[model samples]
Target: MAADTAEENGDAASCSTATLSKDLADLPQDVFLLIITYLSARDSVACRSISRAWHAAFTSEDASLLLLRWHFSRSRETRALVSGWDSRSPGTGRESIAAVFAKVARRYHHLRQAKPRLIEKIDVVQEATHRDLHRGVAPWDRILRWNDNKAIFQYSDPTWCMDDGLLIYPGLDGGQYVAYDLETQRRFHVPFDNADKTVRRVRLACGVLVIEWCERAPYHQLNEREVVHRTFATAYDVQRAQSRSSSSRSAKLAIVRSPSDDSSAWTIVFRSEWKIHFLGLPLNATDRFFSTHNGTHYALYIWQPHRSPWGDDDPIEQLAVWNISFPSAYRPSLDPAGTKRPDADLGPSVIQRLTWRELEIIGLRQRHTPAIRELAMDENNLYVHEEEHRWLAGTQSSIFPPRHHTVRCTGFPLVGIGPIWYDECCADGDVHMSFCPRSGSTAGLSFADADAEAEAEAAGNRAPTPLPLTSYRKSTWPGYAPCWRHEEFPYLTVSDMKDALAGVRVVARQCFMVEALSVFVMPRISIEADEDADADTENPEARFADEMWTELMGKGRIYGDERWVVGEDAEGRITIVRF
Candidate 1:
């Protein structure tokens, strides 16, 4: 009789709890959203385990919604969960916020361990003619393809993109882009968005390029076969008496292109290599260069290097920013300052801008103590993103540690042990260098300051601080900032070409970023507190794990040993569970 009474009490308690939770569930969505909004990531994840009915209530929403809320709430685990959902949703992006939340909330620790750095980028096209008033050229040229391959003899650098496990070399002319696989020797030309212009000079950073192009025929389009849509800036320029040629071909272009079209008159603009230390993919890159005309919207999209192109990088939603078009009369092909124009030269300088996304992604590796496995940047400092290794001076023999060191000219910093920053801080050496905690920190230097430091390499002097490097703008989350942005005059979109810009339009500057990563964790994970599991500094891993549990209901597996660990779900959710 006593046992029966106890069982009845427990059952009654459960029923009452379930009934109350059910009532809470029935409240207006805004009310529920509001009620739950105040909860911490830990509390929110715990809510799902509140009761079976509550689980049914919250778990019903797409995980992304909750994850999004988590991000807004500044939950690192929640951000990771939301990020894991990246490229997962096809069109609508997500269905059930609860489902998305559940998927990542569980791995909140992993996300914190494998936190992604927000890379900033800038793209500008410089232009010159009987036109505007600016000594320093901005990438802003209204570039299009011409008819004959011989017509435009100029080119730009290759901006790197990923597709089908092949590296996309987006140059001024798609004809020159080379695709190859380490496993397979397969190679192919990356189709141009516009077929009319020929490539000239090109520069690279983080496996990308800062390219310059010369116009060919009226309607030159590279990546015509690509699914993206674009818009231009100017219909016609009034350079006193410049004539408006047949440019109807420039408007209403198609997406796809034929292979044999023989991209007309393309050449590389210039190339460059990365200069700043980095990890991950890259933050932003000078990998690609540009310019534009009046009233145009130019945009540069950065692609993440993933195991599977279809799975890792999203086709859309990766674009950095929009800008103006390339100007009418500047060309990298032409020699500086009235040099005699060559038959091979494209024309006078038109537009000049560099997207710095490569540095952002590549920042992942250099955040921690590194072992130089392999890494590479582009030439000309335009753009660069690559992974390689080199020898380093060590106490023992030349030892290749596990971590890697990196630098990108685009501008960003990270530290880590693994493939991303936040892994380890290596010691200083002739070739190998690491960050040493200092008493004071400074800011305010330009990319040019880095250039000057390089020029003074013989002197071995400390370079000035750079504001842009420190200017990274974090998401709503803290410690995440300084995303570079460079916009052009006129903003263009695919829809605009279909509806507006029928005859007149403008172009402006654009921004992009490079995303670098390290195999290292930005912050320690799963460190638990003995006194209060809610707060502990010694055990980052425990804290990470607990935080993840709170976001994900305290479930999931751990990786590595006590010394090191990593967690990324099959869904690409990163979890860190260290004891």
Candidate 2:
């Protein structure tokens, strides 16, 4: 009798299996892809083990592309690289799609979890050359001040910029520049005649390097009444320069120049004198001076402090925008003196100016003076982020006062055709704001207390636990409505870290933070924080696990892109973290 009952149970199990198979086979392609889109990448990949029909659907190109687009819609770089793979090649079977999907999924999973597959460091200043440059010069003579009996080196804030996967910075000798391609692991050195000047800031984009430098006025022209220094911006074309293999051991010892000795390697496409004065005061004394560029458009933003000459008048601050067009051909005749010609029609043009009064008239009413926190630019629009601080009456205060923070984004079109728009969003004082240039989006953290009644109704009398929330807003065009979303992020928050936050990016609905020494990636959506879960534990086929690099601890001045995080260590080394 027991054997008969066991036989009946076995038959029932077979019937259930047959039913699932038939149902999966009957599912339409569009419906199947739609269902897969809702599942996580790991779960979708694991669905192939269910049955032949399930495996076929999950392995199809249509399914893979759908999942990639849905999960990584905000990541244009990832989508561009993954979508170019052809799964219909000769030896590649239908399973190729699944394999590619799994690989891409794992890559981003590592990124989101702050686990890098590889960590590489490159010394910006060669040890031998560093010693040679400081051989005879005293620490005080080289702009180094002694604070607390320790030599404090004074230099620009961000001495480097990363674009198109290349880390470009001024060479220590000031006669050359270094370009290290993070992807190719190759280095290129472009020489320029910056012998007598000090490089204040460096920017690179679209194979062109824009350098801002200041030099002492010629002795013959120097006087008490005249300006003591001159500043200029010069653009160099370094696209065709020869690159050297950086994989060799000797490459790490010194900056090596390429074999090409082309005298015209420093093609000056744009050169203009930059006036450092604003409102009868030197701009270096102002609140902020920011400059950025896309391949086609260049933008310079200056935000001055609020001051009132008349005590009874309201304080006035100014923001000026300069739009410079990059011409493909270099024109020597237009700029014969190597200075900006005011009479010339083709040069940097002041397109827009916004003052405190004008901003107030445009509905950005502020109770306290606003400070410019960040400035970003793209091909079409220039974004200015302003924050106002107001102390709260009753709140727990830490190192910083508990205050309400408000963000206002004023976007201006580069082409000067569309109406200028302004959007305002507010966040709790504790939230750290981050901006993404690629998507024109801003994200921050928002915290709320748990609703006891709702938690009891859902969890059946279990105690409620607070959840951390992420608030995101995308900048919209003139005629479109703004996009905003609030999602639960159970992984980490701004208050949890002790290091200074450098940057933040939101991809695939996951928050990634670039901190001084580490990259913090938010985990997948879950109600509970699973400390034991690996980065790719959900995917059984994952090739790598979560990795931590303690060597990256002292690296500050952090920056990141879609796949790499670049930081500058205390000893002036460039650390690249690849996921």
Instruction: Give the residue spans of candidate 2 off by over 4 A.
Output: 1-78, 81-106, 125-156, 172-175, 190-192, 205-209, 216-227, 236-288, 302-320, 326-343, 351-370, 378-381, 390-403, 412-420, 429-557
| lDDT: worst 10-residue window of model 1 | 493-502
Per-residue lDDT for 162 in model 2? 69
At residue 235, candidate 2 shows an lDDT of 63
**lDDT per residue, candidate 1, 1-579, as tens digits?**
999999999999999998776777677676676676445455566777878867766665433354344332223223323233222111221124454454344444343344322211112222122111111212111121223211111112213322222233332232345443211223444333334433333322222233333334222222333221111211221111121222233211111111122221122222111101111111112122232111232223233223233554422112222221232343322322326433322322212222334333554222122212212211111122222112223222123432322212222211111232232222222212223221001111112233454455336432112123222221111111111110110110100000010011111111111111212111111211223434423213212222332221111222222112332322323332221
Q: What is the C-alpha lDDT of each candidate?
A: 0.27, 0.44
lDDT tens digits, residue span 1-579, model 2: 999999999999999998776675368886676566557777777888899977887877677656654454324322333333211111111224356566556666675565677778765543235332111101111111123222111123455666545677656554366766664465666554556655556777666677765453332232243333344556665453232223443322122232233311322234433333221222132234556665555565444334444534443445455555534233332343646444434655556666667656654333233344445666677766554323212111112422333446677666654667677654431124322112122222211222443455367532222232121222222212111211122111211111111112422221233222233332222111234555323312111122222233232234555466666555566767776
